[model samples]
Target: MPYKANVVVRYKKSVLEPQGQAILLSLREQGDESFLDVRVGKYIEILLEAENLQAAEEKVRKLAEDLLHNPVMENCSITVSQDD
Candidate 1:
């Protein structure tokens, strides 16, 4: 069956996110001080054929590790589900 994988990639806590910081600064300038900080991340969706849920999850995780995120500075989370 076909499966859908959702991947979220974000910088590690130790890494600085310049883009997010810039956004936060802009918001503050606009009088939105409610947000103390902001962090930017990437979201990706992949569709593939898999034998089972386990297989789909494993495949998506591998893809996230190898291509979706940078291990040195980033972490990734993945979710796998059936494609309707």
Candidate 2:
């Protein structure tokens, strides 16, 4: 069966994100003073053939940790689901 992997990659809490900061500043300037902070991230979806959901999750997690994101500065979340 084929599975779909949804991956989200974001900067670690301790890491600085200039682009996110810039966007936050812009929002604040636009009268959105309630905004505190912003962290820009990437979303990626991959489809792969797997034997089961567990296997799909494992494969996606490895891909997210190895190829989809940099573990040093970024953190990743992977979700696997059956494809229609």
Candidate 3:
């Protein structure tokens, strides 16, 4: 079976997000003061073969932790689904 994984990587609260801050500043400069803050993150989609949903989730989670995100400075979330 084929599985799809969606991974989201974001900076930890204790880490400074310079890119996010730059975006927020740009938005404010464009006259968008309605936004208080902004945090930028990365979204990755992966397709892989797995025996079951549980196996897919576990593999994707491990991938996210090992290669997709920095454990010290970033946090990651993963979603796995069957791919047709």
Candidate 4:
């Protein structure tokens, strides 16, 4: 009965995140080789209830870009749905 918004935030695959690689190495050293293959990335999902799809989409994108993600190192995708 209302508009909903979803935001997904993740690191750019091309960025070299040494920290993530280090964590993977640590996992391997600890003998959890299974975790060694883990490719670390950030993913965030947000749901917004707004008066309209356009508003919800705009609000969520602003929130993600301004507050939730590092604009230089990360990127976000947003989707809004309304069937009211």
**Each model's lDDT:** 0.91, 0.92, 0.92, 0.71
Candidate 3, residues 20-54, lDDT tens digits: the string is: 89999999999999888789999999999999999
lDDT digits (tens) for residues 1-84 of candidate 4: 366666666678878777788988888878887763445555665555787767777787778777888878877777778744
State which candidate has the highest TM-score: 1
Pick by lDDT: 1 or 4, better one: 1
Of models 2 and 4, which has the larger lDDT? Answer: 2
Q: What is the C-alpha RMSD, rounded to one decimal, of candidate 3?
A: 1.2
The Cα error of candidate 1 at residue 82, in Å, is 1.0
Note each model's CA RMSD in angstroms: 1.1, 1.4, 1.2, 3.3
The 10-residue segment of model 2 with minimum total lDDT is: 59-68
Candidate 3 lDDT for residue 60: 92
Clashes of 2: 0
Kindly list the per-residue Cα lDDT of model 2 for residues 24-70, writing each as its tens digit: 99998899988888999999989999999999999888888778899
TM per candidate comes to 0.91, 0.86, 0.89, 0.62
Off by over 4 Å in 3: none
Ranking by TM-score: 1, 3, 2, 4
Off by over 4 Å in 1: none
Q: Write the residue-wise lDDT of candidate 1 on 1-84 in tens digits.
A: 999988989999989999999999999899999998799999998999999999999888888877788889998888899999
